[model samples]
Target: MSFQQNLQSKLQGHLSQIDGRFANVKLLDQFETNTKLPRSYAVIGFVGFYLLLTFLNIGGIGQLLSNIAGFVIPGYLSLKALNTATKDDDEDLLIYWVVFAVLNIVEFWSKTILYWVPFYWLIKTGFLLYLSLPQFGGAKFIYYSFLKPVTDKHLFHESKPASKVN
Candidate 1:
């Protein structure tokens, strides 16, 4: 067999495996069937969960919840976007997740400075809420207004087209 034939066979096998794995997953159906109620509940539940974590402040549990809120929530949302084949949604979630991850890294490096600020965790919790809640589009706005401009300038260097006078 030629190299091209072998490559085609491998590609077909990989695609079949992917199809088999996703055959049982019905994320899109679930999302379409009950959108509003689940989304609202998710937003409320996350808010309550964060509040509980903040108020309780138990030693290890607080840390665990913090990790879950910071990592797992966004990660799951991003994967859901991919699973549903929503390119725009996937991009938005990924951008938000990347920005949050970078901010967390910065916070780690500036722990001493942040520690002096009162209600730091509260502020962070609020920011996470803004990012995670799809009802607000806060993350999308922030990305386009702030991150996109900077990234566009540095990465693509594409100048904006001039506006024509009517």
Candidate 2:
């Protein structure tokens, strides 16, 4: 097993990781047990509420919730990552932030038009969750496949001295 999976298994042996990125959903799982709730129902119902909000596009609240999901979890994780002595955790999350920065830059300019896109908040929230989740490696895949090539060619080149005209 990889270091992260191993570490997580050891640390969160009893908790479920469904509600959000940072916290465990064991409490919800435990509550469901006595109530005899279907596992899938609980999962779907929990997520569906947020998706319903996005689907309805209730003013800006749906978008706000989606954005909160994107930021609050990672912001907390970044702090936890900062306090840890292990270099591995820092390196893992660093890639996520890099991808987020690139996406945010693009979003900044494109957001005015993005509202016209169908289910924009739902799509954005799903993408952000996929990027932030370590098990998925969405961030790493995009970084290596797309961003790395461009940055390696342009950003890295800028750090080198220019050729002399003489």
Candidate 3:
């Protein structure tokens, strides 16, 4: 298949998945019922909302919304993960929370300076999303690549061999 056809096929599959998710949502059901458009169009509405909050002359409101969203979406996901019978999902959530804690610590110290950079909140919110989203596998990658190594070295050292000669 040509690249364009491949891309279009992948996008169609993704849209169908998103539509299915929205169709299951009780709140969005009301909106979907009234429209001929598929429920996935709600994603476009959210994207517009996000862009308005992000780029408009809204002062600190954008930053506030970004922070709230960055927290709330993953917070809800973490709650869902906790309530599930399988504990397997907890590992990613735990790593995500750990990284969030480390992020906040650094942000607490550096925020004043960070805001001077363009779109600091937007960047931070995107980073948090990247860290939390399972599809990205970012939290797992970071934990194993960086955080786990340090902890294992300092906190979980191998037992020393018997010191005395046999």
Give the winner by TM-score: 3
Clash tally, candidates in order: 0, 0, 0
Q: List where candidate 2 sits over 4 angstroms from the true fold.
A: 1-44, 158-166
Top candidate when judged by lDDT against the true structure:
3
Greater-TM-score candidate between 1 and 2: 2
Alpha carbon lDDT of residue 119, candidate 3? Answer: 73
Position 137, candidate 2: lDDT: 80
Q: Judged by lDDT relative to the true structure, which candidate is superior, 1 or 2?
A: 2
User: How far does residue 76 in candidate 1 sit from its true spot (Å)?
Assistant: 2.3
For all candidates in order, the CA lDDT equals 0.67, 0.77, 0.78
Could you tell me which residue pairs clash in candidate 3? none
Each candidate structure's TM-score, on Cα atoms with residue i matched to residue i, is: 0.56, 0.69, 0.77
Report the poorest 10 consecutive residues by lDDT, candidate 1: 36-45
Task: Find the 10 residues in a row with the least total lDDT in model 3.
Answer: 157-166
* Pick by TM-score: 2 or 3, better one: 3
lDDT of 3 by residue, 21-55 (tens): 66668767777778866777877788778867765
Pairs of colliding residues, candidate 2: none
lDDT of 1 by residue, 30-95 (tens): 643577433334444656877787646666355456556667777787778877855888777877
Candidate no. 3 TM-score: 0.77
